[model samples]
Target chain A: MTGRDRKLTRFLRIAAFSIGMIFVLLGVLRGEHLEVFAKAVRICLECIGIG
Target chain B: MSGMHRDRVETKDRPGLHERFRLLIQLASAALVNGYAAGFAGCKIFTGTSKMVCLPVLNCYSCPGALGACPIGSLQAVEGGAKHNISFYVLGTLMLFGVLFGRLICGFLCPFGLVQDLLGRIPARKLHVPEKIDKPLRYLKYVILAVLVILLPMLAVNQFGIAPPYFCKYICPAGTLEGGIPHLLMNESLRKTAGALWNWKLGILILVILGSVFVPRFFCRYLCPLGAFYSLFNRFSLFRMDLDKSKCVDCKSCENVCPMAVKVTEHINSPECIRCGKCKAVCPVDAISSRFETDMLTRNVAVKKVD
Candidate 1:
């Protein structure tokens, strides 16, 4: 790839990483960590066809 | 045995060191996720706060020994909750893995994939569904992801004002194998209460297992929504397969060894590629490599040079 193209590719990778990190941070801020914890601790009876 | 038989029985490529190591890692990950507690005596699943984190595999959350939550199950829980909220964390987590490694998780981390791989090792006449049929059938998982996993949970609610995760409730053989069977074996009360739905799920699970013996990764090829979702990100994932055109002689050795049936030479980075690195291992000329690539820019540069 040309020098300019390589520079652009690097920029895009950084952008992708930045965007992904933001989403991850948003998820944590939204209390998703605790929400998942609450759901995970208990086995859903329905999931195993008990319900 | 005739000349035709001799020609057909081309010696299978022995699992190279890389493959052996990959299998070892898969087994280790599977064991780690499925808790190491002694017997199946405890009906209890690990309820540690750490269980909040999602593992990228199709392992069942209800698996009595599971240390982490299945991403798909946790996703459905969030969508099916009374509040009916979209799970940003689950989506973000999935996106993170999808973007970073694409379906390498399917290749190396999924317990169900390991099970399928083992079943395919059984000496039997293997079957390959015709590409005409297989190509169309692959779209089935995308539909399952769209309708059962996402749409149904978001739109359809029962009388209790809660939407059930239709995919987990109605399908998901992994759930039956990892969670239902173990729980039923250990919990007498559960056995006594088993009904038609349980029997139905058991039948599906059995069918899937049987299918795996004949067609490698039947569920992964045709029914795994998690795989389908991850495939969407394969095109842009940081880790990708790169075919060095300068070195390639078009020998098609890489394509011949691919378990996922990817047209390796044509589209080395196809979404269907599990990134198992088998193609790279099998390539005679060392033309294939799996690593981070600036393929998008490379493609664009070939089309129109950036000044």
Candidate 2:
């Protein structure tokens, strides 16, 4: 029973920590890859047939 | 049968003061957003848009006379301005909002969310998006943020010698529809020169609006870069929902009320949650409540002792 409680608690901790960090990482990534992303957009737009 | 019905009636309690307060919060938030939109649209800030503090909510920066800047829009603008060798005042402003309120902006005060709520209220039946499709579609907003929001500006500078907000251009039904088309219709001068672009934007707005009638906050789920930014703050944000299992009556009222389909008992702080407070209001045994930073620590201690 105690082991179950500890495991559940550990799961919550990991879930909470990982979820929060995902956003922080995504936010950072957004600002980081501006140049590569911009070029990709142009090529993709042309492929699909619009500017 | 009648005796049993009256017995059930007596057992079912009426709503209390807390319920009233919750309803009041919803009414006030919706009114504030709608009133501001009407006022901004009218340029009658004294009456219409005057109540919108613009600090707690997201509003487009290029909006005709918008008093405040959208955090995401500002971020992109600042990034673009920097690439063009200009000061990133816009991005700086966005960072300040992100740090200050976090995702509380989404919970308490986005006019677009209010629009979704109103559309959801329409008499038409609510449509359920299948989990298979909904799950995958949720990621589209991020891709939009990555490519349309981030990538386009970077490329335009590197290759084309021009940079513009691509998300706003291609995908943002908000700016194109919310701020652009409506304002132009009101201004006769702007209408005369209206071209294919205006028509295209109007068509996009109409399609999104129709989709919204069937889908709950489809734009927030799919398109809004601002929502994308605020979601980053969901965890560290001081505001939170607390569950007290001590009451031990897992009635599941909170889970049933959540519009976002969040497993409220499990994912109390999910970014998908807009914090509408409906769950807290509906709990029959008062199992859920709102918590702020330090107070939540005390509650957690209390929760530890519950069993």
Candidate 3:
């Protein structure tokens, strides 16, 4: 609630938001969307340990 | 043990409007992600475009009803892939969730958390986990996150240079319940081929379900890697608990009511806190509040105005 604390919180918020946005951009670039789709569509029996 | 703590329960026997609304949101969120008609038949996993992104909760990706992928499962899959690539998308999404709401997801949105909450209402004599054992056991989830979810998948590769999602394969009661059981129930062919690993997972699922009846959120408190991951960001999450020391009565009522056994007065924004608002609800002096105060920019500094 002090002036210093308020400023610190503000700075931290900006920093956190910046980092989150960067990572999201990286995710779009790094994540293989087609592979994600492939994994999502089929039932991996190994996931449930049958096969 | 304090008089205020004892008095707190009687005064608020029935849930207030906010609590009712929270439960409603939790139910709706669960159904929204996993409401596919084909899910009931367990014949197919949804291959929709929505499945490309991860949901904040621990809903299994393999669940027939799941429209969104489980972040933990996706992270493991990404780690175990032939590329052995670290999933910035999954990590980033989870990080965003953590910084925004923290474990409020556990309290208000997770389908698995809803299961535990309903089971906790079974009227059984609650088994209070002693703080000595509980404190150390809390670290187990972090270890699981590091080892089973991350490290094992990254390290333990086969002849094809790919690894399996060890956590989902060996642990994850969510996958077992939402994916395994449903598939087995619907697909008669799978039941005939059910092996020891399947039985092992079933045992773990049964134990977690029974344990929830006696200890509220047993999996969350001790086993959920997702909760552990979210807990790390609780201190600085956008939506957070704030204790106005000026209004506090030293009554310890908040501590008494907290399901997570968080020492609220000691650490108002403790990482273990699920932001259930139970402490705020029970506070006789209106000292405790949950606020959405990120910065001066979007500061909604509404205090404990809940009735």
Which candidate number has the best DockQ? 3
Give the DockQ (2 decimals) of all models.
Answer: 0.44, 0.05, 0.49
- Residues A1-51 of candidate 2: C-alpha lDDT, one tens digit per residue: 144543554444345445445543554454533332332212122111122
In model 1, the runs with Cα more than 4 Å from the true position are A1-16, B1-15, B293-307
Best by lDDT: 3
Query: RMSD, each candidate, Å?
Result: 5.6, 8.5, 4.4
Model 3: per-residue Cα lDDT over B153-248, one tens digit each: 888888777888888888889989888888998899999999999988889999999999998889999899999999988877788888888888
Please report the TM-score between candidate 2 and the true structure.
0.67
Per-model fnat list: 0.50, 0.00, 0.44
Output the lDDT of residue B50, model 1.
64
lDDT (Cα) of model 3:
0.82
Regarding lDDT, does 1 or 3 come out ahead? 3
Q: lDDT for model 1, on a 0 to 1 scale? A: 0.80
How high is the DockQ of candidate 1?
0.44
**Model 3 chain B worst lDDT window (10 residues):** B298-307
TM-score of each: 0.87, 0.67, 0.90
Rank list by lDDT: 3, 1, 2
TM-score of chain B of each: 0.89, 0.75, 0.91
Q: Candidate 1 docking category? A: acceptable
Docking class of 2: incorrect
Candidate structures ordered by TM-score, highest first: 3, 1, 2
Show the colliding residue pairs in model 2. A37-B151, A38-B151, A38-B155, B39-B48, B39-B49
